[model samples]
Target chain A: MVVKTVEGSFAVAEAIRECEPDVVACYPITPSTHIAEDLNRMYADGEVKKYIAVEAEFSAISALIGASAAGGRAVSTTSSQGLLLMHEALFAASGMRLPMVLVVANRAVSAPLNIWGDQQDSISQRDSGWIQLYCETNQETVDSIPIAFKVSEETRLPAMVCMDGFYLTHSVEQIDVPEKKLVEKFLPKFNPEIKLDSENPLSLGVYAMPSDYQSFREDLELDLQKAKQSITRVQSEWNNLTGRNYGMIEQYMMKDAENVFVAMGSVCGNAKEAIDQLRANGEKAGLLRVRAFRPFPFGEVAGALNGKKNVAVFEKAVSLGGAPPLFGEVLCALNDLSRKPTVSSFIGGLGGKDVTVNNVAKIIVKIKDGEKRFEWV
Target chain B: MFEVRFHGRGGQGAVTAAELLAVAVAVEGKSSQSFPVFGVERRGAPVASFCRINDKQIRIHQQVYAPDFVVVLDEGLLDAVDVANGLKENGVIIVNSKCDASALNGKLKIKEGMKVFVIDATGIALKNLGKPIVNTAMLGAFAKASGLVGLESVKKAVNERFEGKMAEKNVKAVEECYNELKQ
Candidate 1:
């Protein structure tokens, strides 16, 4: 297959069409609209068998849940407020252990109204029991679709494939899209035995008595913990077919890094510039990009940050009235280390704000100056 | 690495121009990325876009702060925005206007050593494509002024983006403006 220059949304759409899911039900939202629109076009062309028309994000996920329950390989997409509307359904989809994939074009939640890129939408739902995978490039966005499907079906846990909304969605770049044969080889058709049927009558998601309620929640947690392994396995397996490697978290220039900045999604691109320039000037700086947010990858994150002199956790989303979410998590990951380094939390790029190379360089300087706690760039 | 910023109104094909340049560079076996600053801007609103071309893989996903070249599709944006912000010391400014390079230098009041190039792209676009969209025309001038992309590559890119008569007219717009541009 020849590499094509494409927008991130269009690449994801191509991957989705190649994946050939049984149903797609989504309400259009900014940044995420292209994904749904492209899928809609495929539906019009008879490439997809079912495309459900739902009124709201709430109904969108509910309908996908029904489709998955009826033995259909279901998929849907939403962002920000739409994700908020589908909150209950998100938990239900995972609680019932349904294998569905929700493509999230991550965007900022709004009180003042913004349509640009951010990680807040998906970060808010980090506890909703779905496997969250954050992507950095358009090529990664295309690859994550089938990897998502494979992992979701294997573990019976829903997965959210999140890419920075307009940053990647609107930007055009070079990417190699896998062919249909590779996709089919990677993911087989959804087996009917997984769904409800008259041949094998059973009860699911039934009301649990108090004695067994705690155990059910325990099982969900255990399944999620096991998902960390499956996520890594799928990435390696996909690498065999495509010759590209996507890790749970990526470490760049970490071999002798004295100061490290941790981030996710598109900001990593700018961070690389800061690292390169600082290294040129005899400074030891590096970056760690956390690709798997839901499973968290705490051990790998802590290991990468262990011996560094200082660390800065920067994010586009803030937890509001608390340490920013990513910062809090990184802190939790590093808390038990005997030789932990200085950790600081910084927030920038909120509400589609520009996360520039200079902003990243400033964060590095602040880390050197021994700044503690949160600072906005 | 060569960085460029494009200033224009929404629906003026500024983003399209950036993407076309990126595609052209990619077609030539280089790495490039292009995107709009006003990702969700409304039609007719002021918009800015950026592109970066490099022999190696270009990874930074930030706006073009210090651009090697800046293309202005509408002269009205000069008063409405800072058209000269963060321009390199020896940068080039390409404008789509009827004035000559000397008047553009006086109008923009650019720094010493900075070069200004002028093309009546709006006129060429109107004459050739029957519209005020000077993006492709400016791109043709950009290729000539910066010497980053060949004229044939620009024409092929424009042709790939548009179809039949529209593609032919846009290529004509590019050729006419690039040939007539004054520095």
Candidate 2:
């Protein structure tokens, strides 16, 4: 049975319930508050089990870390500054190889005090060693929750499901929510290979001497390297069950396209629409949606743009004086390709500047007409 | 294919209005897409949303420029946003206002042959829902003016969205607005 509803916050809560998460640790923040509120209400009403309201975002993640360590399917959610507060714990979660899932309501980091939508919060946490999946719609937001859990548990690394705040979080949309039985069928009980057990009394987070630290780090690197394949396998299994397929990257009308715009999150929807309109108007345009940002599907992305003439990377978050964050990654991914497409980086939608289809259409026209390094005004 | 843009403020249910319209169109077996272009706009600050309804799949992801219909949920936004910026010649403009349609024509520049429907949505909301939020009421006027979807479809959509007393009140408001348009 498919139920239609609005509000991504409630959608997240419903997905969490369908997944039957063993533990949910959350802290309240603007935009992200509704997600936690919905989850807490569900837990209080006995719709879910073990809802832990922590004092801070740090503690919220720490609780999930603890719960996951004890072999429970743990999850949590946060945004912007709250995510920054949990930065230290993020590294810890990755270092210990804990497969916890986090819902990051993407928000602009504050200094001038902007509570709007952007990707800086999640983009800044790129080095946190968690597998990040950006969602484009409320349906994708709900769909990614169960997928995140499966991917994280398979790779034994944390997964961050990021969506634009207010855009996907607070905004209401008609979302198709999967039934409980189907969700259960898709995602079975998570059983971690190595867990903290009192009977075994295994040592976790033990002090690593300087000499052995490198080897431990190497093992972590190997696990993350294996995550790329793991994500594909799990997503394939999920597709078999739900008939809704997702990937590390999803290419839209990219076949035989000359110009391609690469983006993630909700903006991809706008970009895809622009591409379709352009194509109908007899322009060769397409979109490349980066679903899995971490383990950064470099091979798949490079392969998608193999024959494209030009590519535009639209980054929602800026990297100070550097190139747009996602653009930089795209460049690095295609650095060694023998015949690479000319790439232009466009920085936009920062501090929540409505990146409309008009903006995307303009970008495509510019790229097709041979303008590079443009910024959406 | 028709694209409608709704301009209002945060907490005014502009996005909700778009979703309800999408559902109504879907009830007629037509394809529709409804999404909001969110901003840092707080309560009373200007926000905009878009809805596209067509007999086929809407593959264009662009914002609705040159919209066939424009619904102004808050008259106050008229000063800040040019609600008639991209209105087509045959388009319809539905506004929630107490002023006369000619008054809006004087204040705003619209193309010739474009239809304008003005309703005291604030008055309807005050009487029916006990609030000045005019999204639903203005949506009622939009359905009547544009004929994009039948009143029955919109009433069913509204009833599906709201429940009990609130649903009854909104359904009544929609029917009342429809009747007011008919006369």
lDDT winner? 1
- For model 1, which pairs clash? none
lDDT for model 1, on a 0 to 1 scale?
A: 0.88
- Per-residue lDDT tens digits for candidate 2, residues B15-103, read 88998888888778777777777544587778888888889754444456788998988888887888998899988888888888888
Candidate 1 error regions (>4 Å): A198-203, A369-371
Error of 1 at A229 (Å): 1.0
- Where model 2 places Cα greater than 4 Å from the true spot, the runs are A1-5, A198-200, A368-377, B7-16, B31-50, B54-66, B73-85, B97-99, B120-135
List TM-scores for all candidates, in order.
0.96, 0.89
Mind giving the per-residue lDDT tens digits that candidate 1 earns over B1-183? 999999999889888999999998888889988988846677888899999899998777766789888999998887787777899999889988887777766568599988888888989999999998899999899999999998998999999999999999999999998898764
| Residue B69, model 1, lDDT | 89
* lDDT of each residue in A192-285, candidate 2, tens digit only: 8788898888978789999999897888877887898988888888788777789889999988789999999989988887887898899999
